[model samples]
Structures are given as structure tokens and as C-alpha cells.
Target: MSRKLPLLIAIVVILTGSVYYYFTFRRGSARTIQTFAYLRDPASRPELRMNAYTQCGTAPFIFPTDGLVGFIWDDSFRPGHRHQGIDIFAGTDVGVTPVIAAYPGYLTRQPDWKSTIIMRVPDDPLQAGRQIWVYYTHMADAQGNSFISQQFPAGTSEIYVEAGTFLGYQGNYSGDPNNPVGVHLHVSVLKDNGFGKFTNELEIENTYDPSPYFGLPLNARENTDTIPVCN
Candidate 1:
């Protein structure tokens, strides 16, 4: 049949160029742009500042137990709804301690994201994926086997965390402390309301309220939000 019609038109032109290279080059090369002059966000759009980053707040602190950051939607699953991030109470064990990189860049992974640490800032070309995530939900079992050291049975890795190093330890993995009472450390920061805003898969409702990027300055017993004058 004419050589099977040129092998079915070369397998439909290589499956239509792999679905047009997965939406124009793998989801636009997993978009990344915020490249540290200090992870910018001066209220976002100033023509989207292609440089001079400065959301500067977290760059440091990652404690796993100093408590008092609150924001828990898992108040046994949603008693009052709020939890977008920040928990640190680490008590029930698994305290191998050392999860940093509050401000650096390039390290991504997302498998329903139960274990995460993303910080991308490819030199502020308008801070592309403008990321910042650190979620280790009650990670017992030797801090989830010391965060993907290798042996990927579907564990996801590329664990390069350094800007404060030590990315593992502190467990409870977000539940079951005799019906949930203690063991914390949930720290988080990931604001996404730009770049084609999202719909659902809940990035904390497209986050953007990380207590003013954790620069700390609200004391009515904390959590009044918006306090990042990062200078």
C-alpha cells in the first residue's frame, strides 16, 4: 500500500511534533525569570521589572520549631480555613534538621507536591515562574528518607538546596499527632497571580499573601498580613 503510506506519514509527523513540543517547548521551558537582586516583587508590575529583584524578606530563617506562624486550613482538615503556609513546631521526632534555600534559584518538582522546595530566579527577566516553596508536610520516616537522595521509585529529585543548606528533617508529615495536636514546620512562599493566572490544583488559590514575605512586623499576636517593605 505504497509502503504503508510512508509509514503512516512518518507516524503522523512524530505525533505532531510531540504535541507541538508540549505547548511550545515544554510548557515554555517550565517558565522561570525572577533572578535575585533579591527575588523582586515591588508590588509586581512595573513593566515587570526585568531586573533588580527585591521581595527580600525570607532569605534567612527556616526554623522548624520556633512556632507562632499560624495559617492552618487543616485544622483537622478545615475548621476555619486559612493555611497557605508557615507552621514550625517540629516535636514528635524525625528532626534531622536542615532545609534551606529561602533565596537562590533553580530547583523544581511537582508530583502533587507533597514534598517541595522550589526557588527559581533566572536573573529577573520579569521573574518568570517567580517561585518560592518549602513544604515538608509532617515528614516522618527519616524525613521522607532524607529528601530524595536517590532511589527514585517515583520520588522525584534534583535536590539542590543551598543558600542555607540542609533540606530535611522535622516530621509528622502534616497529620496524625494523636488526631493532630503538635509537631510542625510547614513554611511556605509561592505567589502566583501573574503569568496566565491559574484556575485550580490549588496553589493555595494562586497564593500571594505570605505575610509580607516573612519580614515579620505584625503584632496583634501576628498574622495581619502585608508587611514587606524589604528595605
Candidate 2:
């Protein structure tokens, strides 16, 4: 038995490594299977596409863009990384899918920002006596060319825009031309700091779960196995 002990130990090590790899990497791939499939055939699901200025179910806010919601709020791609917003994949060529305002607010586009915009809502529709901000990004090309509408050019600030106003088209900008992300719109509901400005949106603590805002299952942890669709 002593001579066979080494082989047994080797087999155990191999099995253990396989299990670990399955859970670590393959599990993430399994989780995103639906997302990738939706990206390939987004037209298969019609309910997932909400038009601009239209509310899903009883949600007070309108859908900002039309596409399959491939990622939801609080989705984590890796350890210690939580996505702060929902990513709506347009399944079309860059700059072909239009993104619109989900709510009426004051829009601002910082001068140097190539792919971002923020809207300030003076009165939070969900919370009383508090302000909030709707943040959108990834609206530029891989080379940092803006796809935003020409009317709201760079340095736009405090311009009141009604719901359904054309904001821009989706792009695959990830701040690096060589490493562009998928063509999607990242929209987040940001909490306002005590001083009337939006807090850091990168932190999940500063962003709210968009489920209640859109009246759908938009929390990644809760809405697995399929892209979020309006019922």
C-alpha cells in the first residue's frame, strides 16, 4: 500500500485542482451564459426592450435605452468588484443604438469627459426630501471620440432636458482603444452627497439598486439565469 500512496495523492491533488478551477472560473462563465446569448440574439426577446419615455410595470422612471439588460446592479465580475450600474447591450454596431433620458433633470457633460454624462434630479422620486443623480457612461468610440448629440456638446451644464431626450448612441469605449468594452450603456442611480453633489459612483454604496427605479428584477444577485425583461 505504501508504494501506491504516491499515486493516490497525485490523483487527489488533480481532482482538487479541477474542482477549484470549475468553481472559480467556470462558474463565472456559467453565470454570464445568458448574457452572452442575449447579446448574440437580442431580437429574440422583445419584452426586454423598453422604448424611451416608457415605464416598465409601475416604475416611475423610463427606460433609458433599448436593448437586453445583460448586466444588473451589483454584478461582480471578479472578487471584490461590484458593478455600480446596469449595462444594456445594444447588439448593434457602435453608435447605431440610441440612448435617451430616463427622467427629466438637469444634464451636465464635463468638458474633458469623452464618454459620460450626469443628470441632477432635484427631487428624488423614490426618496422624499433628497436629491439624486442619473449617471451614464460609455458613449464614446474606442479612440475617445464622443458619440453624444451635438446639441449637448462638451462642457454642457445644468441644461434642463425632458424625459426621452436624445442623449447619445452606445459605444464600446473603455478608455483604451485596444481594449474597448462591449457596446452597452452603463446607467446608474447615484446618491447625492450632503452638499448637493453626487457621491462617487464607482462605489456600490453610493449607488442604489435600480430594481425599484425600473420596476424590474435588476439586482444581479437576485435575477440570475436570464436577462431582465418587463412582465
Candidate 3:
């Protein structure tokens, strides 16, 4: 027991701290790397961002979260840079807000960042049979080890999950504990090119309009509802 004191302390720290990383918006340079950035509408608020994050444009999909909240799809973050994904503000803090698998498929974390989760849904209608990779980032509660990886581990870096399986929580922890973003979920999807390869999500052609994917209007700048999902 004495020799294992260090291990015990680490476990307690993870359990108590909730293990959130917020390296930066890039999910850390080494741990990058995906989308979900938008300019906030002055008329509305952050809730709109959350709404865009969860809802798709039309049928065949619904808002991933309980309901629409702060902000959503806004491509004005940088000049000529269109936001490829929707930003969802789901949690009041770090560990409490859980994000589920949008569609059942294989689960894997980003290259260097365990906080950034990538899910491969192999049966996307948009893709003939190439598969779609749902990229989930900004997990404020993710440490070096991922919730999905910790729960399901194998030799390969691939872990399969159900359509609505519990992926992890929605957080703003990027890749370092020192940096924290606005505390939201950056969700995006990409075309899978087989062999576990995926197209670049930042490239507009490489990304999908999550609005149609989630069955909601992400471009709602008219301000109808606004609440701090990140509250």
C-alpha cells in the first residue's frame, strides 16, 4: 500500500478534479484537431451556439442535447473562414455535461489530444459507403486518458460505440489544463476515406453542414431563445 501511494493519489486527483483540459482552441497544437468556431451574434447569446451544435437542419435527426440553448453556427470567427461545425454549450461546468455518440460506430481520440474524440459512423447516407467521422472536441473534463478509451480499450486505437452511447462530457478544455475556452462543445463531421482515414474537417469540402445532420436551423441570428447552457 505504501508503494502504491503515488498511484492512489493520481487516481484521487483525476476523480476529484474531473480531469478537464483547456490547452487552447486548437485542442493543443500536438493534440489538434477540428472545428466548431463561430462569431457570436450580438442580438442573441451563447445559447444559440449550443442550439446550432445539437440540432440538424431537418428530418432524420434531432437536437443531440435535451434542448436548444445559447449559440450556434457562425462562420465569422475569421475572415474568409467559415465554421464547418456547430458549437454546443451543454454544461454548467466541466464534468457534468455528457455528450453521447451521434451515431453508432468506431470511437477514437484525436492524434495527440485525448480530449478531442472522433467517432466514425460508417453508414452515412451522404457518403455512398465511405463512412462519416463525427469529431467532438473541447471536452473540459478529459485528461491524458479518455473516457471512451478508459471504458473500451484494445490493441488498435479503435473503439466502437452505440448510436446513443455515452461518449463523454461537453467541455472547453482543449489540450492543456492551463488553457480554457468558452466552455462548449465543438461538434463536426467529416467523410471517412476508409482504413480509419478521414478528410480534413477545416476544409469546407471536407466538412458537412451539421444543421441538416442534426435537423435544426443553425443560422438563427434572429434571436428567439437564449440561455446559458454553459451555466
Among these predictions, the greatest lDDT belongs to: 2
User: In each prediction, how many residue pairs overlap at the backbone (N, C-alpha, C within less than 3 A)?
Assistant: 21, 0, 32
- RMSD of candidates 1 onward, in order: 18.5, 4.6, 16.6
Sorted by TM-score, highest first, which candidate order results? 2, 3, 1
24-143 in candidate 2: lDDT tens per residue?
Answer: 444335437866876788777566565556688788789988777777886767756778998988888889989999989999999998999999999988887889999999999899
lDDT of 1 by residue, 1-231 (tens): 997999999999999877754433222111112211112333443332211123344534323332233332211122223445555442224554434444544455545443444444433223444533444444344224324222222345454554444445455543333453344456555543345222232445544344444444322123233221234
Worst 10 residues of 2 by lDDT: 22-31
Better of 2 and 3 by TM-score: 2
Q: Give the clash count for model 1.
A: 21
* Candidate 2 segments whose C-alpha is farther than 4 A from its true place: 1-31, 44-48
Per-residue error (Å), model 1, residue 146: 24
* Candidate 1 TM-score versus the reference: 0.24
**Largest TM-score belongs to which candidate?**
2
Per-residue lDDT tens digits of candidate 3, residues 1-231? 899999999999876555322211222222111112222332333333343224343344434443233344434343345566766654355666667766667887645665677777767855456678888776645343353335633232577777667766666675665666765667777866557688887776677766556655543232122322321
